[model samples]
Target: MIRRLLPLLLPAFLIAAAPASMADVQLKDARAEAQAKALMETLRCLVCQGQSIADSDADMARDMRSLVRQRIAAGETPEQVRGWLVERYGDYVSYDPPFSGATAALWFTPLLLLVGGIAVARLSFRRRRG
Candidate 1:
């Protein structure tokens, strides 16, 4: 019985040991972790909504998080990492795209909508009162 259990337990133990083997790859410094988390939050998950890649538990998110730490530790600045992600995943993967010609509407549209909505409401109120 012990022998039978050993085979089953051994693989599980090995699998658990694998992450430890790569433990050096993990970012333990609080400041580094905070930078990682902040960068992740600005990234969009290709698979989920309003959910940033950092907040997601999906495999893609994990991969992205690992990639972020790797890049940061290798001396890439935060902006460079963001640019790399844009090159790899395209602008859709970023919650915040730079204000430029193609994405100009994205940055301005929400504020425009809000202003237009308030104006319409005020006009309607005046009409109703009159």
Candidate 2:
């Protein structure tokens, strides 16, 4: 009975002891860590949908985290690093992508929808009152 339970308990213990993900690693310096953390927050994890690279544990997120630190360590400014990533992966990698011809709709669609919705609501209310 004891040996049978030992095997089951060992697996559970190992699983519990294991780190959540390899992305648990961080930069040694406080400033670099903070800077990388901030920059990573601006980036989305392509593999994890809604999660930032800083928060996601997916393999791509891990690589992004590493790259952020590497660029920062190499004396690249935060904006420069962000631009490099965007140039490499396109605006989609950044949570708040820039406005461009290709992404013009993304920039204006929400305001357009809000205006349309208000117009419809106003028409409905006026018709009801009349």
Candidate 3:
């Protein structure tokens, strides 16, 4: 019984352990490929949250990588591709979102929070000392 199951189990194990398929197909031009890769690194992987599309293995990231490569191969500039993605997915998709009225809060919130935190800490320390 064990011998009979061994073959089936072996294939299953191999399949399960196999790495995920490559996300982006290489562009014909090396320069285009490099541009796609750089742009991918700037785009966040929605599924993986912290990883860039270039580094993520999630399905969404894979699709994003393919899209970037396809657009770049079609003669779109990296900025154009990035703009399209930002329009489609919103500013959250890019690691470095452009500053604008819509994104002002995103760019300033951290600085505001740090200042607020420092003020509160200073007050607390003063109160404790007095």
Q: Whole-model Cα lDDT per candidate?
A: 0.79, 0.85, 0.87
Model 1 over residues 1-130: C-alpha lDDT tens digits? 9998998999999876554353235577777767877888899988885788777866667677778887777778778999999999888889878778888889999999999999999999999999
Backbone clashes in model 3, listed as residue pairs: none
Q: Which candidate model has the greater TM-score, 1 or 3?
A: 3
Write down the worst ten-residue block by lDDT for model 3: 16-25
Please write out the lDDT profile of model 2 over residues 52-127, one tens digit for every residue.
Answer: 9888978788877878887787889889999999999889899899888978887899999999999999999999
Tens digit of lDDT per residue, candidate 3, span 4-98?
99998998877644323434558789999999999998999988889999999888888788788878888999999999999999999998988
Q: How many residue pairs clash in each candidate?
A: 0, 0, 0
Give the candidate number with the greatest TM-score: 3
Clashing pairs in 2: none
Residue ranges of candidate 1 with Cα displaced over 4 Å = 1-25, 28-31
- Least accurate 10 contiguous residues by lDDT in model 1: 17-26
- lDDT, model 1: 0.79
lDDT pick, better of 1 and 2: 2
TM-scores for all candidates: the values are: 0.68, 0.74, 0.76
